[model samples]
Target chain A: MNEADVIAALRALATHPAARGLRDDAAVIDVPLGRRLVATHDVLVEGVHYTPACPAGDVAWKLVATNLSDLAAMGATPLGMLLGLTLAREAVWTADFIAGLGRVAALWDCPLLGGDTVSGPAVLGLTALGAAAAPLSRMGARVGDELWLSGTVGDAGLGLRMALGEMAVEGVLLKRYRRPVPRLGLGAALAGVASAAMDVSDGLLIDAARLGEASGVGVAIELDAVPLSDAVRALLPAGEAGVLAAAASGDDYELLFTAAPAAAGAVRAAGAAGKVAVTRIGRVLAGAGLRLRGADGPVALPARLGFEHGRGCNAG
Target chain B: MNEADVIAALRALATHPAARGLRDDAAVIDVPLGRRLVATHDVLVEGVHYTPACPAGDVAWKLVATNLSDLAAMGATPLGMLLGLTLAREAVWTADFIAGLGRVAALWDCPLLGGDTVSGPAVLGLTALGAAAAPLSRMGARVGDELWLSGTVGDAGLGLRMALGEMAVEGVLLKRYRRPVPRLGLGAALAGVASAAMDVSDGLLIDAARLGEASGVGVAIELDAVPLSDAVRALLPAGEAGVLAAAASGDDYELLFTAAPAAAGAVRAAGAAGKVAVTRIGRVLAGAGLRLRGADGPVALPARLGFEHGRGCNAG
Candidate 1:
């Protein structure tokens, strides 16, 4: 069925008397006597996010990781997740998938409570729920807040490119694509330290622009300051490739946040304590547009943007 | 990719130190205030759940409804949800899909929070979250508990079969499949009343069998007492089709709960007050096996079971 029909069917079912107008970025559960819950969901389809050749365990791990990445963006701690698994009539593959999920859940302390299973084309959809101290949102940044990005960017995009045979990578970047690390603890710790934040699933520039849009502020990013992993640097065509890589690729899953200038030291301290890297990449400005500074001068920003699923397939 | 690779890709994400294993039916979130959040996810593939001609709005509505139905089965209250949207590259259809979801979320009060969008071979996934009262589960029913079902059965099944040209229907039943009612409030009300509960999704008999297995008990369903909609009754082949429809058809989304005889009155009162039908059609016993009475002695149950996606495209 077309999306329209499907949405209609869903709407008809989800419409309970008290749950009306609950369609927002997160569902609002009114806790009568306890803490509120923050929940998020995401799905990765085959031939879209990964390939048939990718290990099934890797795919399962990525599904949970990606959703947790969203919770990390919100500065929420991992609660648990439910998996909706679709197998292609292969019992062996399904067992491995579950085992893979079990391993990571054990490592992350993310337990599998329950979910549904069905046979179909191979695809994995995971819904992760986390507890919020004070629900972190992408729309809470303030002007003049120091913009920070945790960990390096563009590795996953490069990793995917390598898998697609468009680039050659010998090490970590490929691993980055296969397994992108989400800055979970760093993000959660930033809950009080940062004014606004979100994960960078889309490339940095685009996601920054979105953060700015959501926060009603402008951002000025120093192109040279953005963190680039050595792996990403080695595979790029040139130094300018950093900007290109950061701007046009996807799957970074890093946390791009804005904090008060005074809070930078404390934020970095927390990151260091957690063994996660935090870097200053830009600053939130009281303007209307995003400006990128370069080595020569203000170069024309790339007209093309980050991944948009079906829309950006031909972008590169 | 195999399930292993998929799991690997998912598990490699940044993790919180306290996150428990996240590969389960419900995500357990520590609210820090003595409140635990239980989360679950669901997806309905096109041409698998409904005909491709079904409206996109309906599909969107169904996606939320189905997940909410899960929460209802757990005796949980609505919280919020995340949407994983995969557009078909058709702007018109995508707009309609969003609109329908908007309507449902607005009506249900469960806002669509953060979700990922991708372009793919056309699939829709929605993960919904809800608050649990005391961790209701499918494995808590005791032997000798009375098995009760809310509302009529066989309507959605009959409607689906009718859509496939395998049967005939008059009214309501067709609408039931098009938009099955999820008894969220009623289900939540039964949290303290029912011993074990689950939604009637994979046919009454199969799901009842599941509940039985989960509780280490047996179920004896009185076919003569099973409630059926007038549409179902009118379409059934005289004599035995009524029982078959009740046992074999699915998509009812009604609550199948087992409660002690002492709690039956409260359940009946709650059901009536909630404006839903409550029917007692079976009882839990201390053994294993499902038995159904027929017009002439106990007849052998249908050898064919409930719908299993990808099994037979022509299966009714």
Candidate 2:
């Protein structure tokens, strides 16, 4: 996420026992006294994620943000972070990359901590540490909670399009992809407000369906209300194309939440306090399927949705 | 370091406010008020560090150990870690790679936490999180602090030669390269006792010179007393080839440390408790230089030495 949006979005996280203000070396956390910890790891490779043409500094910044986004999806507060950097062993770029990371990490208050350095292969790997308070897992959303999204959506996806010259947009959407603002604050704020929550790294509609499957429920979204930034709007030919693209494109890094109807006000208030926009997109239902209520009535959803680990998008 | 040594080493870390043990999903750290954090990162690419034919699992295990090894040298307790994994999307050995890492992480007690997973290339990136103790640095050693090594040295260096089939030795030397032991416990144990301490990933003599430069001191090493494992000795050619090779080769992962003479007993005790050997390899002296005393008077040290990030090493 862009530094400003990330700062703004993270600022919404109220002080809690585990994660306080995003202002220390690492997020302090308290876990249950005796349970074997469950930890899973993933890594992103450069050129595979973004082109080398992208700024090295942003590459460093985005790497840290991506890892933190995972922790947010898992309902964990960051404890600390480590980085594994592989560059060409060229003095100039490596130094710049580290300096950029140092600056961004300082802004977020997450210290670099420690990691290994090696030559060969140009890649950057980051490991983020986070603790769960009754982890609000991808498998926990209920059948009746209303579906909600914190802040805008599809900005990063569109931003990437603009970066690649595939689409042209103005304002935030382009900025979103180049730099995503991770909703760490919104994630922590959702702890007591939502039944289940996850960050939208994959496309929202697709991720929503996955969440539904995980929770053994179905989801229905009202296309009219899906939050789309002006940047996403600028990319399409002004109608269904824009809406559909926004719905299926990923990398928003927003907190998608399912909460009881009664808690809607609180969720909105929480989102607003951090100046993040909250939108009611859909509802979780009893059956096991995903439905979209577009302007043309019910329509079949795209099966190839969201980002898969090894597989590229079906659209590509 | 391999899974076993990593477990043994991490288990030996003294009780701390941050790390609970090597068994949690994420390390629970207690950060003090005020003061920001400082962090660094690096990643090792396969074929660059070891052959692709190397056991994939051991390679995975070593990745975490190497990163954690850095934290140990920095005097930072285990905080959290991240992994950036890249593998051929269809590698037959991918599952084995992940499983080996899971096993070692389970033993080390650090959780997998969060990271990015990408397709393309075949490499492993690991980042280790650690709580920083301010004024904690490589530059902490001073003039006159007796230099010490946590355990018997050169086995890994010797192990490398054996791995390359260049040396026809047997016993621990092979395992040495395949499974270097990270001196986590000894390094952590030296936290208070050592004025300056570092894990010897590079050879003893080279790393010693680095410590001296960082601490603004000179160094004098006694060739006769450098500890050598029985496993290493059994495989070495008669004379000083093994000793000389061990002194210059990297990948030892031992803790090379310096302390005031009064702390010698404690340093030795720490090593004993960790089950690693310790020896009076050298002493920090005035001015800036390194001197090695052998039977033939002060022998000329290697003109250029150690593993530089980009420069090719005989071990690599």
Q: Candidate 2, chain A: TM-score?
A: 0.82
lDDT of 2 by residue, B218-277 (tens): 989888778888776766664455676667777877877788899989988878766778
Worst 10 residues of 2 chain B by lDDT: B30-39
DockQ of 2: 0.25
The lDDT of model 1 is 0.68
TM-score of each: 0.83, 0.78
Q: What is the lDDT of residue B142 in candidate 1?
A: 92
lDDT of each: 0.68, 0.64
lDDT of 2 by residue, A237-294 (tens): 4665566677787877787779899999888876865468889899999989788888
